[model samples]
Structures are given as structure tokens and as C-alpha cells.
Target: MREVRATDLPHIREIYNYYVANSTVTFDEDAMTLAEWRDKFYYLNKQGMPFIVAVSPAGQILGYALVSPWKQKKAFRFTVENSIYLGAASTGKGLGRELLGELIKRSKAAGLKEIIAVIADQGADASIKLHRDFGFDEIGRMGKVGFKFERWLGTILLQKSLK
Candidate 1:
């Protein structure tokens, strides 16, 4: 695992677009263009957030994870929200766990004191389990807060302390 590079954007976009087109994991109604994808990272980079990707022995990106400000205000600087995406071919092989492990490690190293996860209520059991397995606890749930895939979707909030 390592920090994401400019070249990794294409693979990251590919993995993200797959879900945008076929899943409700992301609430984005449409796929982002290459330029938009580039823009997505600009703010995070400016905020000194960590965006990392896991690679295979041959160097193919297996998955990616990132942290963003839980809130942009100064008072929220101690916390971050995380997002993880795995290539279609990468799931079920512990790639997500490895990527997330790296993300959590980096977050702590960066002095972040808390990590929050916002997971889709449906089709995210594994994600919930992953967070819980790493010591996050379910803090709350927002029912039907997001509309996606022609239906209202809920979000589950989980939190973990870094210190």
C-alpha cells in the first residue's frame, strides 16, 4: 500500500464509476468525468488528507482508501470521514481490509483523533463489519436520507477513536 499518485486517478475513477453506474454505495447520480475526478482529489490533497491505494505483486491497483474532513470547520479538524473502494475483481480477498488498515494507520499518524464512517444501509454489511472489526461502533442511522437507484437509502454512522 502507498499514497495515491496522479496515474492512479484513472484506476480510481474506473472503480468509482463502476459503483456509480450499478450500485447505490455512492449517492452520486452520475459518473464523474476525468476532469471532475481530478478535481475530487484537489481539495483533499490541499487539506493534507491521505488517499492511498493497494497494489498487486504485478502492480495493478487492487483497491483505494481515503480520508476527508468530517466537517470543513476548524473545530472539526480532529476528525475525518473515510471512503474505501475496491476494484470489482479485488473484493473477497482481504484487499479492502488491507487498504483500510493502511488508511487508519495513516490517519493516526497524521494526528487525526477520530474516524467516522458513513455507510449505506443496504449492501454494506461487509463495510459495517469491517469498521466494527476495527473497533468502530455504530453511533447512529439516518433513515431514507439519500435518494439513489430510484429509492430512498439510509446511512449508518460509525465512529472510532484514534487516541
Candidate 2:
């Protein structure tokens, strides 16, 4: 795993867009464009947040992990929302664990105080377990807050303190 570079955005976009198109892992109903991805990368880069990627020996981007401001308000500056996505072919190989672990380490180094995970209730059991295994506590849940793929969906909120 290594710090993400500008050139990695395309692969990152591809990895995230897969979930947007095929899974409820992300609530985004449409695929994000490369421009949007660039904006996000710059935003996080400007905020001094962590955006990491795991690459294969062949230089393929296997997955990515990042943290963004949890809210726009200045008071929420110390807290951030975490996101991790792996390519479909890269799952079940402990890459998620490595990415998430590195993300937390970098987040703490960035002086972030808290990391929040908003996970979809369905088709995200591995994500929930991943956060729990890292000591993230279940804060709450909201049911039927999202509608996608012809059904109502919900979210599970998990949090971990860097302090």
C-alpha cells in the first residue's frame, strides 16, 4: 500500500464505480465521473487527509482507502468519514484489512480525532465486520433511508476514536 497519486484516480474511479453500478455498498446511484474524482482527490489533498491505494506487482491498482471530512461545518473538522473499496477480483485476500489498517494509521497521523463509517445494511456484512474487527463501535442505525435497486435500504453507523 502507498499514498495515492493523481494518476491513480482513474483506477480508483473504476473501483468505486463498480460498487455504484452493482452493489448497495455505496448509496450513489450513478457512476461518478473522472472530473468528480479529481475534485474529491484535490479536496482531500487540500485537507491533508489520507488517500491510499494498494497496487499489484504489475502496477494494477487493487484497491483504495480514504477519509473525508464527516461534515462541512468547522466544528466537525476533527472527524472524518472513511471509505474503502477493492476491485471485484481483489476481494477475500486480506487486502481490505491491510488498506483499512493503513488508513487508520494515516488518519491518526493526520491528527484526525474520529473516523465514522456509514455502511449499507444489506450486502455489506464484510464491511461491518471489518470495522468491528478494527475496534470501531456501533453507534446507531437508520432503516429505510435509501431506495435503490427497487428496494428500501438502510445504513449502519460505526465510529472509532483516534485519540
Candidate 3:
């Protein structure tokens, strides 16, 4: 895992947009703009948070993992939410495991007390399994909490205690 750079935004956007447009893994409705993503890059980098990319030796971005504040409250400061995405052709290569493991390590090192995952009901077994493998436990299930693609989507909350 390596720190993502500004130049890596294109591939990151591509990877994320794929999930947004094609999968229920993320709740995002549209592809983020380059400018919007730049702000993200700056925020995570400046905050010393992990914005990790899994790259091939040849430098192609294969997957990425990251964490953000679980909530915008001071009481929630030690908790963070995690996200991971692999390139379309990069699935089943163990990159998600490597990336998520690194994310857990980095988040704990940053003084986080917990890692939370908000997973969509559909297309989330792999992600749920990945988080479970990393020790995240299911906490709640909200039924039909989201509407996308002409259907209601459920949300599963999973958390791993970092303390």
C-alpha cells in the first residue's frame, strides 16, 4: 500500500465511478468530478489519514482503501468509517484483503477506536466477508433505508473495535 497522489485521481475516480454506476457497494448516485476528488485527496492527505492505493509493480492502480470520520461530532472522533474498491479486472486477487488489512492497521495507528462499515444490502457479501475477516461484527440492519435504481436498498452496519 502507498499513499495516493493527485495524479492518481483519474484511476481512483474510474474505480469509484464503476462502483457507483454499476454496483450497490456505494450509495453514491453519480460519478464525482475531478475537482471534488481533489478536495478529498487534500483532506485525507492533510489530515494524515490513510488514503492507500494498491498498485502493481508497474504502477497500475489495482485497488484502494480509505477511512473517514464516522461522524462529525467530537464524541465520535476516535471512530472512523472504511471503504475499499478494486478495479473491474482486479477482483479475486486478494487485493481487497491486503488493502483492508492495511486500512485497519493505519486507522488504529491514527488513534481510532473503531472501524465501521455501512454496507448496502445488495452486492455486499464480499465486502461483508472482507470486513468479517478483519474482525468487524454486524451491529444493525436497517431495512429499505435507501432508494436507488428504482428499488429500496437496505443498509448493514458493521463495526470492528480498534481499542
What lDDT would each prediction earn against the true structure?
A: 0.91, 0.97, 0.90
Candidate 1: tens digits of C-alpha lDDT, residues 1-163: 9988888899899999998998988888888787887887887788888999998899998889999999979999989999999999999988888988989999999989999999999999999999999999999999999998779999999999999
C-alpha RMSD for every candidate: 1.0, 0.5, 0.9
Per-model TM-score on C-alpha atoms = 0.96, 0.99, 0.97
Locate the minimum summed-lDDT window of 10 residues in model 1: 37-46
Candidate 3: stretches off by over 4 Å = none
Residues 92-159, model 3: lDDT tens digits: 98999999988888888888888889999887898899889888899999999888888899999999
Worst 10 residues of 2 by lDDT: 1-10
Candidates arranged by lDDT, highest first: 2, 1, 3
- lDDT of model 1 at position 153: 99
The superposed Cα distance between candidate 1 and the true structure at residue 86, in angstroms, equals 0.3
Clash number by candidate, in order: 0, 0, 0
Which is better, 1 or 3, measured by lDDT?
1
Question: How many clashing pairs in candidate 3?
Answer: 0
Index of the highest-lDDT prediction: 2
Off by over 4 Å in 1: none
